[model samples]
Target: MLAFAGAGLWLLLAGPADVLGIDSGNAGMVLLMTATWTALYQVGRLPPEDVVRVGSPAEWKAWIGTAFMAAAIAYFLTRGEVLAGVTVFNDPHAQRIGRNLVLLLVAWSVLSSVMASRWKGVVEQDERDREIAAQASGWGRGALVAVVIGLAVLLGLSPASRLAWASHLMIANLLIFALMWSCFVEYAATAAYYWRERRWQ
Candidate 1:
């Protein structure tokens, strides 16, 4: 899928373009997400005869939208409608919408996960499930560390004049963005691993 590794290259080489009202940076992510859904949804389209392998991905597919939605909320909350430099938390107009959306989304995801998954089963997670989860966990942690280190380098090495827009509030949301990104990475990897196993079947 062009939306995987290729998509990032396309985004970097293409620079930034306008699509409708959104920038290529945002649109590029949507493109990648479309690919994620396209690929991962195929797992369910032809599930193998293994409960352990099929269980996590099927459930993860259901929450892909949730992850994307949460990311969007974070994106919006990280900026002001008039001032991109200020976080929604400090921007009066954007704060209310961001707070309410975050609360509702968190609640919705929790309920959705509980309802969609067969957690009551005696088997719970098998060896395959544990393996996938562990792999995903490692990926998430690595992504988080990379994001943090990158941010530190940018702030530490760059001249203050060059980073004039880096408000305290903005820095705070950047950390939030880092966490969100790591979670998204973990989720994508989990779903991908699950989907990858299905192709052979």
Candidate 2:
């Protein structure tokens, strides 16, 4: 987990900077957001017996509360800053980048928390759930593989398609994220079932 955190920090510093063309302040905000977001995710995933039940009304309240919390964090992190020096909405590229980042962070937090809550029910899985999970995993894997191949071809042809390269890359990144997320969901479902099965037996 420390290794994972370290890698995330590295990506936030090196990868997001180059991708977003952001300098120090924006980079720092993004890094802080990423770190906090990850921390919240881990907190949400605490074992059912160890933490608040995620699907309960209280947990729902917490999830909504955290969205506001995240918004506050984003505003404070970006407020009165160099990146905000430019008109936030006027520049299409900057606006899109910022919007994507914000939405991604909030949505990740909400969804992860909900899933952690649902994981309690997931612990009671049966054979039907396992079979459905198997199917989902198979389909998700195929789709993920296809997307990777398609993206690779697009990357190879990017030099030739220079006119829309930026747009292509941006969309490609979104699609890659979606595919990765789907694959992860499938794997998580399967793993959860096996874990529950072990506990049951």
Candidate 3:
């Protein structure tokens, strides 16, 4: 709850100015502070029951992967565009999104580390977990391959003279989106497997 609130507050305070290219320096600092505070609060204070409910190693991995990938997708979706000869970090909106994404990843890492430290010996992965992970990984790899092939075909078929069709930045973003989508699918599949296992047991 506190984590969510922190993220919402950060977005509310920094999102508009970032998108509009105003107050970049202070906005970045505010975002960092909010993220640090949120991460510490969540890591040190979240209930043990809530952490335990995350289940085995596989489930924990799935949850963390899903979260980070979801954040990445959100960041990329909100990031306006990359201009020629301009670094992504130079753009205010992109920098804001990047910072938020990094914050999310850091927060999740902190949470996961805390949970693992507290539950050290109890979170072992059984054969079932290994099997589910293998299956999920295969599905993720397949999805990634399919997406890459599709994108290659689309780009290859497009007319060279069309600016929108041939934008390197767009294509790069699409590839990143495809990768993130694959990761999300993998984590979702792993979570489903864990749910099914629990349901049957």
Candidate 4:
């Protein structure tokens, strides 16, 4: 939960406007995207032994298609402009690309889950996956600790700076970047762990 705590501290210090760079409506949508993406990934990652029948290949295909469509909707509404130039078609095309990428990721996750579940025998535990996850967790925690200490030291050194408001906002963004980066590192580490475990066995 340190990641969440750090994010919270960042938000408290920086406020949503400075970090998110949008009005409340858009900011809320960004939050929604983050939640939706994470949820989609989790839902697509059910263990093989769950024995729920999962559905046929056709059903899986439909689910993937639906995920892509949902992503498309989200991309156009939010991140589409991120890729734009001053030109006319730039924004729309960028939105399409962003949507397509989201769809690809969703499709890949579903497809991988389906393939893993198709194995005829018992699924073995992957040791490398465990190690990677452990490392990721360590890094994430370390980031949080370092951030808190740094903020404390900075504040103690110059309490007057906090009144400037920008100081806190800067700290907030740093915390956000740290938390996001740590989370990403952990995810990569976890994926690597699984790959290595599969390889070693």
Instruction: Judging by lDDT against the true structure, name the best candidate.
Output: 3
What TM-score goes with each of the models? 0.61, 0.35, 0.68, 0.34
Deviation (Å) of 31 in candidate 3: 8.2
- Checking candidate 1 for backbone clashes, the offending pairs are none
Question: Which should have the higher TM-score, number 2 or number 3?
Answer: 3
Q: Per-residue error at 51 for model 2, in Å?
A: 21
lDDT of 1 by residue, 47-124 (tens): 344533445534454256445544444445444332344544656444633453354346446545643453335355
Which ranges of candidate 3 are over 4 A from the true structure?
Answer: 2-15, 18-54, 80-96, 106-111, 163-166
Off by over 4 Å in 4: 1-125, 159-162, 166-182, 191-201
Provide backbone clash counts, one per model: 0, 0, 0, 2
Give the distance in Å from residue 150's predicted Cα in candidate 1 to where it truly belongs: 0.7
Stretches > 4 Å off in candidate 1 = 1-54, 57-66, 69-74, 77-83, 87-90, 116-118
Tens digits of per-residue lDDT for model 2, 1-201: 455444544443334435457543345445555665676578666766655332333333334444434343433334324233444335654554456456545655665576566556544444665575676577667766777677678667778556243453355444645554454545444545445654797
Superposition TM-score, candidate 4 onto the true structure: 0.34
Q: Which window of 10 residues has the lowest lDDT sum in candidate 4?
A: 79-88
The segments of candidate 2 whose C-alpha lies over 4 angstroms from its true place after superposition are: 1-92, 95-105, 118-123, 157-201
Report the Cα lDDT for residue 168, model 2: 39
